[model samples]
Target: PEGSSLQACDEAARKLTEMILKEDGVASISTYVGESSPRFVLVIDPVQPRNNYAQLVVVAKDLKSRKNLEKKIKVLVEEQLPNVQSYSRSIPLGPPTPYPVMIRVSAPTDALAKEYAGKLKQVMLENKNVTMVRYDWMEKAPAVRVELDDDKLRQMGLTRKTVASALYAEISGYSISQYYEGDQAIDIVFRLEPKDHQSISDLGTMSIPTAKGAVQLNQVAYLSYENEDGMIWRRNLLPTITVNAGIADGVTGNDVTNQIMEASKEMRNKLPAGVTIEIGGPSEKSEDSLRSLLGPVPAMLVIMLILLMTMLKDVRKVIIVVCTAPLGIVGVILGLFLFNTPLGIMAEIGALALIGTIIRNSTVLVDQIDQHLAQGMPRLKAVTESVIVRFRPIMLTALTTVLGLIPMFPSDFWRGLAIAISCGLTVATLITLIVMPVIYCLIFNVGNEEK
Candidate 1:
């Protein structure tokens, strides 16, 4: 609803709690006003500068996923409120934002922004991965339209300020004076008693002074209700509406983003001139972060491979070592799957680190095999001896690395990262030790050539 108030937000939150009050794992729903969030504003003051915004902070019983419960709460709120025809729910996704998808629709005017945002939101919902969708650029609420007649004002010898002051004093109220008691100070407010200004008709009875003396405000101005922007939002001085959504469980953020882009061609035809859409929020952030990290990946690989080649002087051995490095992912994939952990950026970084350690260990084992080969030992014996000689050292190195990350598994924040490195290194180390000899034998035909 456009022109919604702090009170209206509270009412919605109140009803949301009423609907989910009996649901299991619901602790409480705490609501506050004017912070641009529907639930849980993380600001310092209890209240900030007045805006038509607020949030409903919901606490659940321990570490429970209350996504379904939140969906039910939205359905109830929309059903009860006539103006609130649509509703969506999201919890704290923690730091950054809770919404899985946030896209910005910008246009020269509010109407265009609203139209584009609505269309984009609809397209996003078509993708099954997206569970909930809402846009901040619209308002369904009706505003109190107060218009003063200019001719009547001139005839009555009155100015706009006097009538505005009277209306402000009568309805919005005003601070008359302040009293200082010791070190404390308090405002003494004065205004028409609640009974006198409870309704529009009563407010019209307010008297404003003119050159000809006092006259009723209603006689000069007309008061009515009209639909308007229920909420106002802007970005970089351009009219923008942010469309956000709650994603379904097991759905990758990238998957939903790909759907939105694929649907964009058709969606663009519906948009008016001067309206444009920009991908944002988690989807945008993920793309950017991955791009930044991956930019140097090829160069890093080339440099590492070059260094390994220089040390071994054998391209086949270098290729064998690199192939064994990625065998660590077997453990990484299994660990996350067993723990039900989502693969995020942290996990990607951990994988990179694990690969680096694997290569270093492989290089050391390869050096031992080369040393024995230089002494004219049989290729088969040299490969067998190398494995036995490197096993204890490689195991101890992998053991320390895994032990260091042991505490991270129990942590919510670091678990994804720790699981990737710890499990990947453990599995890769064992595989590399056992498989390197076979890789060396196959690549060089070491035993056959020696015979």
Candidate 2:
């Protein structure tokens, strides 16, 4: 497909546009042949111009219609345009990758990398969940190679340069002179008309200009057809060929990537020196996002602990409050499960927000218990009265926060975060009101004596 002519890509793009335009819910479609559409919006990174590449942008009536049309178009492309390799996806919300599953195979030489890429593509195609398996380095394109004979060139009073120049001028073109208009100069190109040299045989009989006389090109050279690489991809100066694939319905990118890694163990072991393979795409992006999110967590926690220790002045109470934060994770898990939401980056952020709230509630109850103790109440009375006094405020605070998050539940981006905060806070507040008092009573030996 990479070696296809520009005309071929243009025809395919037009055909695809016609098919998609017939589908319901599609408002309009733009087709870009031999290149991608311009950067209409900020997120779209346009594809570079290539002889074989084409892109289509389809606009739908609404969000619901768009989702449905995406599925239908995918089916249509596969069933109707079997010969054209195609992929359909909406604009990505996160970092954009060419495919869901990308396996990068790098080697010292381009040929070695491409060879492994083909092998890797075969391995990926074996998985039932992996579809549209292909490599960036496509099949080679046909090329004409001219081999000149030095002995024949000398005998004919023509040099290799003269014959090559004549062949180039006939096949492509020769810039004979430049025409100047104002300060701009334009190339005056010249070449034989298409009717004169319509085939390769005509090239062999072309005449080469020389000082002595014009000589036939066939006496000095030979022409043959061979295949050469259409394109090459490199990463960090090393040739890297990435084998990318799409996942089937009801499967995650990570699941298929893991399967491919496990299946390719034998192939990996057989890799030659200076060759390496790595998993990329969504899995790689996810790991990077997680790392960036978690990098500052330890420092933040240390600062929070220092503040907690300074406030309570009691290691046991500080430990109790710190320990209460993680228990909220149970509620977070339950929240995601009950709401049918995946625990994504937004959800993790909501869980982190729960930590501060839990610590705040625990500190308030503990401080109130101390206040009662300072006012000459017995330890048991102090623990009991603190819970009784703070219970309404903590419960009301959680209820109000949960109600405030109701509007976010319907949004695809913030739904997970909303669920995590609402559910985790509700359960964590209960733990703080009930468990905080009990832990206080036990830690201070309050329950051993009623008086």
Q: For residues 147-219, could you state the per-residue lDDT of candidate 2 as single tens digits?
A: 8998887777877677767778877898989999999999998998877775668777788888777877666
Off by over 4 Å in 1: 1-61, 64-94, 148-166, 178-187, 193-205, 218-224, 252-254, 268-273, 291-331, 378-381, 403-407, 434-451
Query: TM-score for each prediction?
Result: 0.76, 0.86
Task: Output the TM-score of candidate 1.
Answer: 0.76
lDDT of 1 by residue, 31-143 (tens): 65656433235421232334455556667776544666666666666676656534344433334654667788989888788877877877887888887787755656665
Which stretches of model 2 miss by more than 4 angstroms? Answer: 150-199, 202-219, 262-270, 449-451
When summed lDDT is taken over every stretch of 10 residues in candidate 2, the lowest stretch is 39-48
Question: How big is the RMSD of model 1?
Answer: 4.7
Each model's lDDT comes to 0.77, 0.85
What TM-score does structure 2 among the candidates reach?
A: 0.86
